[model samples]
Target chain A: MDNHLFLPILMPLIGAALAVVAGQRRMLARTIVLLATLANLGYGTWLLWLVDAEGRQATQSGDWAAPFGITLVADGLSALMLIVAALLMLTTLIYSFATLDGDQERFFYYPLLLALLAGVSGAFITGDLFNLYVWFEVMLVASFGLLTLGGSRGQLEGGLKYVVLNLIGSTSFLIGAGLIYGVAGTLNMAHLGERLTTIQEPSLVTAIAGLFLFAFGAKAAIFPLFFWLPTSYHTPPVAVTAIFSGLMTKVGVYSLYRVFGLIFPNELARFAPLILTLAGLTMVIGVIGAVAQTDIRRILSFHIVSQIGYAIMGLGLASVAGLAAGILFIAHVMIVKTALFFIGGAAERIYGTAELKKMGGLAKREPLLATFWLIGILSLAGIPPLSGFFGKLALLQAGVAQQAWLITGVAAGVSILTLFSMLKIWNEVFWKKAYTDVSQLPRVPAGLMIPGAVLALASVALGLGAAPLADYSALAAGQAFDVSGYVVDVCGVAGCDAAATTVRQENTQ
Target chain B: MTLILSLVVGTLFAGAVYLMLRRSVVKLILGLILLSHGVNLLIFLMGDGLRRGEPAFVDSVTGAVSANAADPLIQALILTAIVISFGLITFIMSLAYRANQAVQSDDLDDMTLTDKL
Candidate 1:
């Protein structure tokens, strides 16, 4: 019944509408976007407080009861994601203010950015499957606009692939939804979880599971489905790339976590071994690709694929600890990756190129920028006492506990390869003698640096706060495992004790 | 009825896979369109072959519902899917057109790896 749950979603949509109307007026657009995103961050903080106070929160939209009408549900995981997304959005907006100007900003960038936020928030909060689809479309449409904002040769090329692959993914999602509805006779996620528990058709369920995996896999950029990402993600402007790198793909992972943990737990268990194998391959292959790349942005983009493998590997373990590790790693990756991209943007701004070979000796002149970049890279390489280390530690522990030795080995190997890639960038860009004498390069503005620094700081903060975050992740994982809470929140019903008991036992164990 | 739906899905999948392998971007777009239609129809048919049930709502004056309701929810969902697919198709087509204009070729291979990276 609390109205606070809707603010994070509604405020962004309102802002987007207003910003669109204020298009081309640079100051007005920037002011509206910044105020709106900041407001979203503030409301997100308030929502976090409410979640902390109430344990979990759910709201039925328009006073309609659940199951029949749309419901916005905010549990611990949703709240955490909203907070992360809001923080990233706010910082990315500031970064954009410094990076984009004239025609670019005037062409509705702020409004589209706000729309993207609304879509993401909506996706995180929505309880209905159909509603999830709608939110996805909202996000995708905005992404389409943002990805092609620059309309460069590379942007268009990459954007075409991105759009096509994702269209197929969306189509598959629709087909899967239809099949699930056919079998279960409901589109509400909680109701589906309740009814799907007893389905006797194994093959049919497997087919549906495959569809969901394909749809989400493309979005998350896992293994064979990830070829589009490295090329395409490097094309956008820095702010666009930073936010997309930070939040969008993670939304895919989030959906995977949500669907598999809540509605398709048995299917997930059945498919864990397969997922583990793919994850191992994904990590190894992605990093190898990174190693082959000379371009800084492209290398970083490939790392995103490799890092996603670690998250999926954690999910593949299908254990509470594993899921917890996945959630924690997702948060860490969002922060570290965004910061790295912002640094890349800054480097590009300084050198007029993203090619590592063309750049050298940045540390001598821009020590502060170099320090921020170093922190991001070290954290990305999973240095101990950094956020990345704890994420991997949890995942590796889960892998060992689950007897997934191959996955553990590959995960560790990827970390090494990741270090090699980071060192390559360091040697070429930061430590080597100046190639083009960018000592005269323009100073990176405070606006952009501050956002990157905030994310860099968050990476350290997450590492220091690991214990409490891990506990929270475990609770969210518990909720993920037990469908009864979700079902109760969505359907306002109380009779599904058997499933709840099983979930509780599994989580406790 | 279900068999017919499966046939349509199979054809669509076949066409889509075939088109996806082709080098022409336009053909690929066509393949996607066929795939989308096939998927949309498959989803529509998944509702267990339209029942001989009444439409979702009944008129009080007539005291009767439509003879073949066919799951209005699925139909409505299918309509939404159609709209979404149409939008995607339009966007993809425009992208292809723009790519052709910029690269001066309809074949994807015309854009070399040297230029791409």
Candidate 2:
């Protein structure tokens, strides 16, 4: 049963090795990646079902036992993230085919892609802290290859800054994990959570938590630490940028949720104030930067930071409702953001540029593409009956409930700015008359259009089916907010019992 | 002993930071190497100052835990981190080399085409 949890991580890793060995065979590599991603999606659905039916699943690899050996656990939040990642991987693999040329496909694209997918899945499901860091390294290295593969001067420059900043994040993550292990006498996340229940040194734990905040904060691209994102993210090829826009920073956000939500619950009170302040600042700065950008991908890249602010704000609220909102909004942003990038990519392809000024008359040239763009735009703006609406509504409702007046106001303001920039894209890329000599422009291929169309439809369907999604998110949120059950599931009943007794004793005192 | 080790870590970190702030990409890579070494040493010191004299090895016959064994988990962790950082530094070195060759400069300030607002 626990082995079922391993498949999502394993399948991609095995496929990556196989595809790398089958290098230069574009047809074979593409087929391998697409099939592996599809298999992963199916496996993700299965794992979600099992978690839904059986509750959080747990397994300690090699029978070394809990708090001693490596553990893999998947609860509601992990499963939800897993399924979304699988779906994104599947869609983007197909999307890459349409975007990457034959030479690019054979340039280890499929291998690096599968490796990244594996790393992300491994991060989502791992039950140990150090393992999460290891998975992050895996994901980071693959991303570096993909980001710099073209060896263009711009890509190399961008990749340099990216690696420099990311290595700092990685080092901090390792140091944090080490510190936690030393102070808490455990490396297992469940064990750490259990041990931290009655922490005598709250400041020490909070200091470690601050390190994680820096580590994950940089990865998630929050404000004051987000310079690397807009600079480098726009330099990658469209497929690479689109998927990075979707998944990479969210790994940071997810880690933030995990570390704060579970292992450092005792430190949250001391840290929440700083987190809320950062969330507000990240949102304001991200969208304001986006508003000033003229390039389509560059604008979308800035909005990624701003949207991340909303995701973390939920955690900053530190309530069950807030976490549910954060998780829901995270999934919604991942889908909608990917679709927007695809729309931007398609527009860039048509005009042979990402500059909004040079692009126009897409509405006249391609009505279907325009409709897809509108759905993404509307969803991003939180228009009703769209996925983004529910995501924002839940978050806003949570903020109002918490009486977080300032952050909530900033969030609302950012939403308007988001809509305005998105409109700039629509007006310049589609709604306006053709500004360029487009006679030489090729027709927008169905391949490029279909990926965005599918994701755009998913955004709408996510909205239409928001009820079930909200229910799942609420269940996941419950699992995140109170993680004693996760501790028991991973570390066994004995560890949880000891932690519970400590908690009870502390409460009575 | 712990104080002395922490001072070493601090000095390494300071040096790494100073190097990382320079304009040359090679300095940045050197800083990164020092940064990683500083972190690895920090992790070593973080593991409770290495009390035991030998590696933690269980008895073959009785399967009993070694009484005087060190905390091997952190050592394992540092080993893994070393390997990972080794790969990373190589990648960064090559990336820096590539950027230098392509742009005809190693100074980050000169690579301003991608940084425009």
Candidate 3:
């Protein structure tokens, strides 16, 4: 039964290796990637069903017993994330196959993409802290390749800064993991969570938590550490950028949710005010950055940072309702952001540029494309009956319950700024008269249109189905808060005993 | 011993930061190298200091744990870090070289803003 959990991570890894061996055969590589992603999506759905039917909180990987070897545990939160990731990956793979040239497909694109999926899956499911760091490296290495895959001047320049900053983040994660192992004498996350509960050194715990915050914060594109994202993400091709925009930072948010809610609950609760402050600042700064941007993709990139603030703010409230909101917000953002980027890509194709100032009156030429863009952009701005609205509504209610009035105000203000930016794009690109006579622009191919429509439809479906989704999210958040289920599932008998002894020793010391 | 090690790490970090802030691409590469080394050493130190003993998990130990063994996991982790950082540095160096050849400058700001307009 636990073996089912390994398929999501292993399938992609095996596919990546196969693609590397297949090398220049673009057709074969594309087929293999598509099949693997579909298989992963199937497996994700199956795991969700099993968890739901059995009322299982988490699964231990293999019969090898947990904590001693490695485990892939999928709780409600992880299952939700896994499903979102698989869907986004499947859609993006289809989009890339239709759009990117054969040469790009052959050279490191498919393999790195598969490796990235493995990394995200592994990060979501792993039960060991050290294994989480390893998976992060796996993801980062693939991302490094993807960012520079174009080898253009802009790509190399932006990719360099991206690599440097992320390397620092990687180092910080490793050092923090090492410190936790030193203090707790275990590398298993479940074991560490149990041990952390007994430790009396509040300052040390805070320092360790701070390190995690920096490491994951950089990955999640939170405020001061987020400079690398807008520059680097904008350098990639739109297909690749869409996946990164949709899935990658959310992996960071996932880890933050995992560690803060499970391993360092007391620390997070104590530092709630600080996190709330950061969340507000990140939102305000990000949208303001978006408002200042003239390029369409750069504006979207800044909005990624701002949306992350909503997820983090949900966690900052440190309530079951708040975390549920955070989970729903993450899912909504992933779908909506991917759709917006697809539209941005299509708009770029039609206009011959992504600069909003240079693009006008696209609606006149391609109403279908404009309709997709309108749905995506409106959903992104958190309009009613959209996925974004329920996420923000849940978060705001949670904040109000906690009396975090300042954060609620900032969240509301950021929503308006987000709407303004989306409207700005609409006015410039879809409403005004064409800046150039682009009627001669070739019609968008059916292949590209289909994927864009699928993602846009997904955004709406996610919004309309918010009631059931929110219930699942709430269950996940509840499990995350009461993480003893995770500890028992991962550490089992012997590992828990060892961890208890270590915790007792630390308390005595 | 911890104080001395901390000072060394701090100095390396300061130098790395200074070079990272510089305009030249090569200096930034050098800075990354220094910073990674500093981080590697820090992780190594976190393994409860250096012990005058053999590595853990000897071949002959079956039923008993080695009481005097040095922590081998940190050592393995450091080695992995070293290898990964090495790959990243090589990639960054080649990227810098490519950027220089294409744009005729090692200044990042020049590359960024010029492309924007």
Q: Which candidate number has the best lDDT?
A: 2
lDDT of 2 at A75: 82
Best by TM-score: 2
Please state what fraction of the native interface contacts candidate 2 reproduces. 0.67
DockQ score for candidate 2: 0.54
The pairs that clash in candidate 1 are none
Runs in model 2 with CA error above 4 Å? A437-440, A496-509
> Which TM-score does chain B of candidate 2 obtain?
0.91
Clashing pairs in 3: none
By TM-score, the better pick of 1 and 2 is 2
Q: A236, model 1: CA deviation in Å?
A: 1.4
Which lDDT tens digits does candidate 3 get at residues A256-281?
99999888999889878888888998
DockQ of each model against the real complex? 0.41, 0.54, 0.44
Q: Candidate 2, A220: how far from true, in Å?
A: 0.2
Per-candidate TM-scores read 0.94, 0.97, 0.94
- Can you write out model 1's per-residue Cα lDDT over A386-429, one digit (the tens) per residue? 89999999999998988888889889888988999989998888
Ranking by DockQ: 2, 3, 1
